[model samples]
Target: MGSHEAKPKVLILGKVDFAHDAWNALTQICDVLNPASTTREDFVKECQSGKFDGVVAAYRTFHSFGITGLIDQELVGAFPPSLRYLASCGAGYDQIDIDACSARNPPLLVSNVPTAVDDATADVNMFLILGALRNFNAGMHSLREGKWRGRPALGHDPQGKTLGILGMGGIGRNLKKKAEAFGMKVIYHNRRQLSEELSGGAQYVTFDELLSTSDVLSLNLPLNNNTRHIIGKPEFAKMKDGVVVVNTARGAVMDEAALVDALDSGKVFSAGLDVFEEEPKIHPGLIGNQNVLLVPHMGTWTIETLIAMEEWAMENVKLAITTGKLKSPVPEQVDLQ
Candidate 1:
């Protein structure tokens, strides 16, 4: 059949209220179908049946059995080859198996709303930093237990302190602005050096130099082969004694066991985490540490960020319908490639 004669059958493989009038705008352009939930059987059946032209993989609910600690292959096995494009409805594609998706015949087009998470991520990073500095988690629990004190431990000031960023992506740039606003000396280490003009008062530095000189460090790099456990015991040992650390990036980006040890030994003064190596099941040692602050992976949970992400994700899906392409295409070097 001719392309114009055949309408694309777009399916949402996760729970999304596309039925909402505002969200249904795309339905006017294609035959939209959203199953309340997608099981392995359902996904395979749809693909084998040649039913869908594109799919919006909602990252929030698109977890496979492996990620959920269920059977691994079963969840991944459900993906249908019928999908020409997969639109990730969030800032990151960590949930979707991009490599497998790209191996398809036409090469699945993977795209994400990468910009929407910047403000929210910056806020969360800042929250973690302040919480760690003030020992907020410990003090809050103590206060709830009626252990009132004249004053809690003093917190470190960001002003005039060296702030180091592990990666200088969108979130890192936003954070650099925030750090500079507080008079913190910002420095960073990235695989590729950004132009000096856009470094946001952040000096380019060697990884070791960043670790040794910074009073505070925030990791913003993507999780990949070279970066997995990028901050382990060896890296931690290079940092100044009593340095503060915060991670708002992917969980596995740091070595949880090493971080716990640093906290215990006072090699690190305090740490804050919005993500973990094994999410939902954080390292138990950090749980009881008075020097650590933990959050349940809420870096991009703000209302504005969610709305912007959903809208941009829908726009990405719409691009496939109109041009047979994706706007925020996953780079060829990404795992999905």
Candidate 2:
């Protein structure tokens, strides 16, 4: 490149907590811009003021929702004509509106960190499964409140029990190995069945069979239009009595209210949830219930995983700026690539 040629501009929509080396390396190649606005409204106004007119690609973090809300139609429309790519620093890109991005005149290709999060997320999923099955939440609470065990109900063992997984993606496949170590049989249902090799000897069952037979059910799918509220009242009725439910996926994927009702009625023996319908604000029923194990969306809270995610997202930004591509483009925008 010649000194006369201007560096391509890239935008950072959130703070880079780690991966400073990667970010600094990116800055050496592309001119990086950070928004001064602290609120979504101000961010919009800043964009409208042409502060980011020349930004060609953007790297966003999930926490950046505070600065700029969902990357929806209105926000996408406010972006400069030069903006063409979005790199999301998380496995789930539910915060972004892929449709709106793709609808732009020269579509905004979006990428997300996928494999980088698999192990960390799957570890959390296994933790939830064990906690829920063992009914550890009640005992933990009891101990914290100065009571020893507090006469908690008997818990079930994972050994010889069937574990039904919904959406057998990377995390789900990783989870199967962990679950199998505990002597649990694994069954899964996905939009499309995986080959035997990818399935890892776990039986591929129909959706109905999965709901009906499993002693424990794990939700591992992404949150999208078709998947929102995928498990609700009717679906709960299909499960075996005394079944345990676990969700490490997005909250909206399972109906929280319906889950409360099921727990109250003893249809579900226990539940393990890492995500909620409205984060940081949980249903009173779940909070009051001793049978539920809850974690505040800390599936990938480890430093190593965070750094990997940040670096993966930066790689997307780097690829977008230098090669006009993304390292791991979101499934919806694969056609655009």
Candidate 3:
């Protein structure tokens, strides 16, 4: 590299809460740019104004959605011609439109932090499973209200129960070992069956078998067009009576209204949810149901996980500027490498 050549520019789409050292180090190699606009409208205008003309890569956080909105066609088109890489600081990239990014002339390659989040997210999934199966939420709420040992229904033990996992990805595989530690028999359904080693003796059942036979159902798949509302009224009707439902994945993956209906009809015994279809605004049905245990999307909320995610995303940015390649390009854009 010639000393006279200008340094490549990198953009920060959201605040770097941790991993300050990595971010600081990145500053030495690339010119870092921060957006002045807070709203989506102003952001688009700012981009069109050439304030980000030389940005070649960007590091974005999940919370940055409030600032830039969806990274759709319009927003992607507004980006400078020099921009080529986008590093998202989370496992799920549903908020981004990969098709739109691919359609661009030079193609905006995207990467996400995957293995960094598996343990934390799986921990939350296990927590929800235990809370829902034991019907602990009602008793906890009752005790909080000064009631003494209110008559909560008897809870089912994880021992000998069938745990049906949808999506045998990293989080699901991690949860399998944790649930097995509680003596639960695990079965899973994925887009395709896993190898014998990866399956770890867990049965790979069909989708229908998973729904109809399991005592507890856990959703851990990514959200996409084919997966939106994948679990709805018709699917719930096939489940065993008094089935426990748990979701730590994207809220929209399962139909919120249908889940409420299933609970109301006594088809589902209880539910534990970390994500909702419309987050920060839960459905009234779920709120009114005493059998439901809810957490506000805290799957990867731990400090350690956040730091790892930030560092992983920064690595992607660093590699993009230095090597012109992403450490973990999204599956959709593997050919872009």
Candidate 4:
């Protein structure tokens, strides 16, 4: 067998879904050392030993790995001299230690499948909006309890609701289309306005205006310094009473305490959350709240997306290790390479 056919040492960090597609895609190029059912500590030790050539991190194992438990500064010491690429399975790279990786003598090429995740996330956003507006969680709970919620558990209609999107990027745009399909009027507040054509009839509104006017507010903004706690108590107070809030974005983007408070005060009618500020450690206040639906960050949790992500990640790892470049390095690292 050629050296290329020989399995290269690949380190698995945290939890990766060890499915047929994942293994087939990864194994075809390099051997996949996946210990998905194990603890995060073991993965850390493996990488730190510096014997691996490629590192793989995934999103499907969020429930097992917990929030922000993957790649971090503490685990950066494990990058063996052989390590060249740190391939992330999804677009959300908050768990990564970008600075630490960059400071290494030979910086790690961090790659994520950004484009492939948009449609899946957008589908999740619509699900959140519909689920929250329709109070699906509450109705389901009431039904399961052998009690008919009846009129008391009535859900709002999406036909005429206004959906205010905080970010108008790819995921946001896809969500707008889906929301509009349900007869919703889409409005958005982006860092900068997109061209008229790209807006797709989504009105350009100021952040405050969007907050006040939206009957359904969807948080799709990226997590960054300026966007942290973008939706808090003060912002909630400006929204339409009983507004539905859906967050498929990062948990820290909205203050969890504020969301719980708003839910209690009826400022937010219902909340469908796929991500939390302290994820896997859901806010205690949101627990048992009939108006809240919590998903363990499964916005991009579909077989198609997962397999595609794995394929892209392996391609990135192979390209980086063999050609000294990644197919899809994280945006900031693009310039560095």
Candidate 5:
């Protein structure tokens, strides 16, 4: 179809460009609108004036918090009266207010790309684990600043280390395979333990046991009410001293302030984080800390994975508009039905 042909009106609220083919596919199917290179205030104003049939809540789109907060809730309410479906490009929609959407008169159908992101997210989990254990942040900084760590002030190895995975989802399972290849033993705590075959012989333990036995702790869970600040001061105290912390999950999953405190007390030897509680804004204390390795929220951001996610999200959008059903709605949305 030509660009001028009638198509579902979609608001592309992406902070970053989509994979080229993904963008092409979207353009071929939807009439997309993007707010200019604008201020958050201006964007919020535009969002609040929503007039599109569907809204593409891109990886980082958000409504203002509360009455005027930017991000989920605010944007959810911003949907035009004609709105039918809202699809977020990423797996976790904790940033999007599913409850509010559920309460809408004819509730907006929502969806996300879940499985498509697993491989890349898992890769990043391992990257973070190794970086944290090896002190890659400090080492890289030292080298860049013209100082090498005389081979002694280096990092630890994953060999024979116990990698405790907090969430045993697809990403967690992939991380297990890779960690095992590096000679690390894996243990996990999940809401429900996987079968032995699914777990590939990785031990399953209670949360407390996972903490005590883990030499390196990796967080791969979602962010929700129960999961918010799940790893706080008390949880930190329970962990083995010098445990390396790696998070490819949500930032709020770990208490950033509490983590810094643990780092200060020499409890957590180091940390590698890809997501932050208040993302794009690092905790003031974490900046300039040599023990922490921080990356922007780019868990599933490789070329291949990005294309898969974008295409999956668009597929959901297409199905929702055509059949009034989503292929992969969030679990809570499924429960509601």
Candidate 6:
């Protein structure tokens, strides 16, 4: 058989449920190379030794490659750089080094599953907001412990309460509609103002006003150089006392240390966190606290979202192979960092 007749080999790293759909989609078009679960070391060793023309990767694996410095010599350096693309299954390409790949041949395509993630994240944000305001987790725990005899009073109504949003992206705008449904007066701050339609009924406010006046503050901003530790000591100190904070955004956006301090001093009433600065490794200070609730970065873990992400990623990889293009290219508006 001619070299051109041979199917190009594709590699996928890590686990994605319903992966059969993704696997079939690729193998139907190209020769597929995949192992069920691969550790960082195995991943590096395999990518280094294997021959792959393209790779469809999980964002988590990219982070592993990033931290372990395996992306360079392994995936990126594999096969004299005739590789077609490195498509990330999730929205945040922060886990990958896009700029480095941009300089090489057989251009890498940085794509993401924005639609699925946005919906899942929006739902989680609202869940956190409602849960914190009503003390759902705490109350449930107290009830289960049979300590409900002298439990605290019911929470203040969300209706007419000020809802502050730190960013006005897709998830933020989605939360705005849900908050309004609960009769909240929404205010938001973003690097750039949102259009009237996307802004919903929320008012645009200065960061200071958002901090000092919001009854419940929801973070939807990304994690980056400027946004890292954005909700630190000074910002938390300026917030209204006992204000509830909900972070479904990246964990670094809210300073874990500062949040712990705020909760300790009663500056903030409570916090609902679905993500952390160092994920899978929680902050020791906040773990044992009764007032704080933690979820293991599961804002986008719903089955529906997971399936959607896998399908989108698989489609992109297939498209890149067939048409020399990507379906879900990362937009310039998004901070690639």
TM-score of 3: 0.98
lDDT of 1 by residue, 27-62 (tens): 776777655324555555655554433453322333
Clashes of 4: 2
Task: Identify the superior model by TM-score, candidate 2 or candidate 6.
Answer: 2
Compose the digit string of candidate 6's lDDT tens values, residues 47-141: 56554334433223334443334444344654334565556777665555555566556455567666668878888888888878876777776
| Number of backbone collisions per candidate | 3, 0, 0, 2, 9, 0
Overall lDDT per candidate, in order of appearance? 0.74, 0.95, 0.94, 0.77, 0.78, 0.73
TM of each candidate vs. truth: 0.86, 0.98, 0.98, 0.84, 0.85, 0.86
Model 5 off-target regions past 4 Å? Answer: 1-7, 26-30, 33-50, 53-74, 150-154
The parts of candidate 2 lying over 4 Å away from their true place are: none
For model 5, residues 1-337, the per-residue Cα lDDT tens digits are 5656677667666633556666676577667776663565666666565544355333233332222243456656666656656677787778667788888777766777779889898888888898889888887877777887523236899999999999998889999999999999999999998999999999999999998899999998888888999999999999999989999889999899999999988899999999998878999878867889888988877888877787777777667655677788887788543
Q: Residue pairs in steric clash, candidate 5?
A: 62-71, 63-70, 63-71, 63-72, 64-69, 64-70, 64-71, 65-69, 65-70
**Ten-residue segment with the worst summed lDDT in candidate 1?**
65-74
CA displacement after TM-score superposition, residue 334 of candidate 5 (Å)? 1.7
> Which runs of model 6 end up more than 4 angstroms from their true locations?
1-4, 35-42, 53-80, 105-107, 333-337
Question: What is the descending lDDT order?
Answer: 2, 3, 5, 4, 1, 6
Q: Which candidate would rank higher by TM-score, 3 or 4?
A: 3
Q: What is the lDDT of residue 15 in candidate 2?
A: 91
Error of 6 at 138 (Å): 2.4
Residues 187-260 of candidate 2 have per-residue lDDT tens digits of 99999999999999999999999999999999999998999999999999999999999999899999999999
> Ten consecutive residues with minimal summed lDDT in candidate 6?
57-66
lDDT of 5: 0.78
List the candidate 4 regions with Cα displacement exceeding 4 Å.
Answer: 1-9, 14-22, 25-50, 53-70, 151-153
